[model samples]
Target: MSGKDKPKSAPDVPGATKAVRKLGDELAEARQLHRLLVDPLLNTVRAERLRVSVTRSLWFFLACGLGFTTAGVQAFLADGYTTADPQWWAAWLVEPAFAGILITLLRWEAEMLARRLEVTAAVVRKLKRLLLFSTLVMNVIPTVRPPDGHSFNLGNLFVHIVIPLIVFFLAEVMPVVQEMCTRAKDTATVPAAPDVDLDQQTDEPPADIVRPAVAPVVPSVKLPPTVMTQVRTTLDSVRSEGRTPNVADIAKVVALPDNLARQLLADLTPVNGHTVPNI
Candidate 1:
């Protein structure tokens, strides 16, 4: 293609990166708001599904890298090695590249507040398993793995096994990282804004402070036995799924009018520390 015919790339603006980041932050905030106001429990499940996807993606990428590395090295060293230098492959593969990344995870975890369902490092704190796994991986390679090479060399053990084990220990001992983590709960515990009474603050005391007539409290209307029975059944079904019943959802599930469904929900109370929806 001629130089003039080629499409020109857009020039990067000074604050373009910052602007994009701001947009992303706003979007994330909106998502959190939706989760809180719309479907907290359902959104929790969705976030978990997303994390599983991310973890699987990472594993797939790592596997692909392994395959590519194997093929590329084989291709580069065209002729099969009658006497291959095991040390060269050991140097290339034995170093734990991800050890530092794991440390960052540890640091982040250390900064977090403890949760009710707290994580324990009982299993991971053991230095033995990390050493065992890294050593085993090193052994399985053709170029003589680190821990148990063709010969039992002290230098090989220190470089291949010791270092990797140290890295793993740091990942666990510094701060144990959970396989799954979560942000702190944003439960609707904040008190509603206090009622403002501006007239009470006036300098002149009123002769007769006329309090507005209070509206009569509404009585709970009794429903038909059949409808009430259906509401009870539907709520039980919802609770079984570990979800608190909402007006719209209860209406759909029980085939009741939205207003009636809301009325039924009002009669119920929050139990077991679960937040009832503000229907």
Candidate 2:
């Protein structure tokens, strides 16, 4: 056929052509939107931002430790070992510093334990909630108020500071701690059982099971002549039908076999009982 005389395909139809173009345009627009959403996550700036955040956190704890340690040691050296110091400034620095170190270590140790247990994330959330409650209680009670010492006023710092800082450290170290704990747990466990002894053979095949032969006692069942004749006729009919009849059917028209129907039926049934009636 000539090209002009040939039938046009669905895409070549005027309405279908417009629908295809519209669908293509929509798909392109959706693809563009997806790219725009994902681009920010893959950007170099975002990667650098994450790196800087982690670095800053490490430095922050290090700085805090150094500051508190320096203050404690300096104050202890400067003034003699009395609670009531003549120099109030040294007392302010020293007491709070000691407290800060103790609190920080407590947090660090608790988090370390949580991480080792592989429950850091769960423990952190619980600890944060607990710390917040503690902070609130401390704020409400004047005697239990936190000491004021550094630029980081821990009086209210307990509310905003320690809990979240501990949580961050816990998050950072948890995976490594969990891995170490898992390794330690595995090492501590008893080893698995070795393979079975292959030299010895198992018992013979199940189908070849050797049962002791017992001479069966044939029951002396004296059937009436009429019943016997009816049985013979029914059996013949069943044989002609090419299927064994059930015990119930035999009982209705004749005498049931002296042997159990299931035992006799198994021998007579065609197609392994599929063609026979079951009683």
Q: Using lDDT as the measure, which candidate wins?
A: 2
| TM-scores vs. true structure, each candidate | 0.25, 0.22
* Candidate 1 per-residue lDDT over residues 1-279, each given as its tens digit: 997787654334455576786886787777666545544455446655654565455444534433333332332333233336664454444323333333334444555422313345565334335543544354334234322334655654444444434434434443322223232111112112233344357776467755446843333434434334555677778888999788865554233344545655766545685634322
lDDT values for all models = 0.45, 0.46
64-181 per-residue lDDT for model 2 (tens digits):
6434434433443443445565563464555345435445644565445423333346765665445434333323332233234424344544533444345445434534443443
Evaluate candidate 1 by giving its C-alpha RMSD to the native, one decimal: 19.5
Q: Flag regions of model 1 displaced more than 4 Å.
A: 1-37, 61-123, 127-129, 132-279
Query: Which whole-number lDDT from 0 to 100 does residue 131 have in model 2?
Result: 44
Name the weakest run of 10 consecutive residues (lDDT summed) in model 1: 184-193
CA displacement after TM-score superposition, residue 272 of candidate 1 (Å) = 22
Counted clashes in each candidate structure? 1, 0
